[model samples]
Target: MIISSPAKQLNSKLSSQEQEARQNGYLFAQLVRLYHTFDGRPGNEYSKLQDAIACVLDKIDQNDHPYAYTNKLVMFIEARHALRGLYLSPDQNKLLIDLRENTKRTNLNYVYLSAIDATSQFK
Candidate 1:
């Protein structure tokens, strides 16, 4: 879905941190939209958190923009927590837990992969 967000228009004048926040804010908004729109069992929602992250990441990638790992990680953590009450398999839960733990480090690339891997296994 195309989101009509001003954040999509990155201003070069914005500092690195500002750009990162703008991107993170945009991604967070999308995540919230997904949660509210498809908030139920995996079968009912047809909207896996993994896909949501993927979509957000894809947008960032396509734009070839520099982003802050911390901002992205926080957004992911918030999304995961937002869906905490949803029905999830043990593996999925473990993956999220691990992702949360691993994200503490400076590198956060693995969290993306882990999120994708976890959802593929179960919702």
Candidate 2:
């Protein structure tokens, strides 16, 4: 038996979207690492992480690329979900919730699924 690959046009589109999607994935991974490193503790590190996330969001907001906007919104949602698992204070939780809501209000699409799951579905 033989299986055919996706069409060239589909591959091209997926490749372009994948570039931004991968960046979003990386940001979420970084947030997860930070959450692990500072679980249940409020300190400079936590503040720094929050600042970094804000900076990323600001950069995304300034970006005119549609893919960048979608990627950034997805990253924000993923990061917020990852942060929720960590033992964060009420204030921290509120911050994440606010971030999620703000990102949701953006024009970008925020469809999210595990990378592996998405890839498998495509296959």
Candidate 3:
């Protein structure tokens, strides 16, 4: 009996879409970390709740759906805000926006799987 490798390997080089999807996954992991940090720290609970709500509304207003390409940068900014109480500088914001714009549509399933895989690695 001979062992043969399949044409499509899990460790194969990622396509551009897969790479972007993986980055988004990593960004999401960072956001979760920020949220946990913010939650655990001693602070004004009311203010934290307010800021969390505001962040959700801001994402909705900006049409940043979780599966959409725009969500990556929105979550990035929002996570930093949650962690540091500050937004990205204008240049940084513009750079994220440009990157988001350049990413084409990706398979939602692939994105979800990639995000899950990326986040799982953190633990």
Candidate 4:
């Protein structure tokens, strides 16, 4: 889905930190959209799920633009917390827990993969 022009303009004017916030907001919006589409599915929808998640992470990695960094961190933290509360298999839950723990030490690439895995399992 296309991000709104006004939002894009606003995002373009943010600081690096602020840019992260805008990216998180955009990512959260996309996840909500995905949830609506895959809310009651059975088994895993790996391909589309990964694509949706990658889109968000790609935006995050493309942090050359201005952003709301604090806001993005807040949103990402909140989203991750909420996601942790959803029903998941033990392995999926473990993956999320690992991702959360590792995020403190490593870059966020694995977080994207964990998101895809968790959403595929639970959503």
Candidate 5:
């Protein structure tokens, strides 16, 4: 005999919409951890945030969520500027529009889950 739990059934039916519903907060937290990792290590924290964004840009398609993703990125850039209060350009909004769109990101949920697991180790 075999029985599946409701949660199991729900997990099996998750589509891109479900994935889109869940934003990448774990990844964002990991990035923030990395950004603040060098508080006294003598390097530019802003550059570290740029590197984090670069890593994300390498993995994510621009069409992942367009306006939503761009807004999130803008927030990241804003967070990085909190200390300096610097007025600067994110330079990622236009690229988010221009980058080629993918019809599907088959592994986005898996990626997010992995991020959650990876970041959990920090606790």
Candidate 6:
């Protein structure tokens, strides 16, 4: 869960945008780790599941970061797509979809999300 080093030690000179990218990269890495490690379970109380939820939420929240909204949406879509293989509970899946849909409504850009989907085949 401790994804960052001390800001003074590592990012003392980074611009706000650089710091934001660093944070987003950490959350994206967490999502990828969760995708690899989550047990194929339908339980909501699993720690990894909770971690995945947190990472997803954080990624979506980054939409409001100073960086472009489209870039953040792509990141969110990529992270969400990475979790697709996990055997999450129905409620968990609904929560994720709802989060993405809520972000979509506010960001109002399906093309960005679709772009992630379109490029996923290469991965």
Instruction: List lDDT for all candidates, in order.
Output: 0.47, 0.47, 0.43, 0.43, 0.42, 0.45
- lDDT tens readout by residue for model 1, 86-121: 554555554445444533434445435455224431
Tens-place lDDT per residue, model 4, 21-108, is 7645654554444334435545444344444444445444555221232223323434644664434445444444543442343343
2 versus 4: better lDDT goes to:
2
**Poorly placed runs, candidate 2 (over 4 Å):** 1-84, 107-123
Which stretches of candidate 3 lie above 4 Å from their native place? 1-14, 45-123
TM-score, candidate 4, is: 0.28
Query: Which residue pairs collide, candidate 5?
Result: none
Candidate 2 residues 1-123, lDDT tens each?
A: 866567877888899878866655544544344445445556554544455445444444454433334345335534544754434556545545544553454544333324421211111
The order by descending lDDT is 1, 2, 6, 3, 4, 5
Q: After superposition, how far is residue 22 of candidate 4 from its true place, in Å?
A: 0.5
* Residue-level lDDT tens digits of model 5 in 1-123: 889999888887786556654444433444344344434544465555556455554343433433333334444555555655644433333332222122123333323322321222111
- lDDT score for residue 111 of model 3: 29
lDDT of 3 at 16: 55
Q: Write the per-residue lDDT of candidate 6 for residues 96-117, one digit (tens) a residue.
A: 4543443343443433444443
With a 3 Å backbone cut-off (N, CA, C), the pairs that clash in candidate 6 are none
Q: Which candidate is the best by TM-score?
A: 1
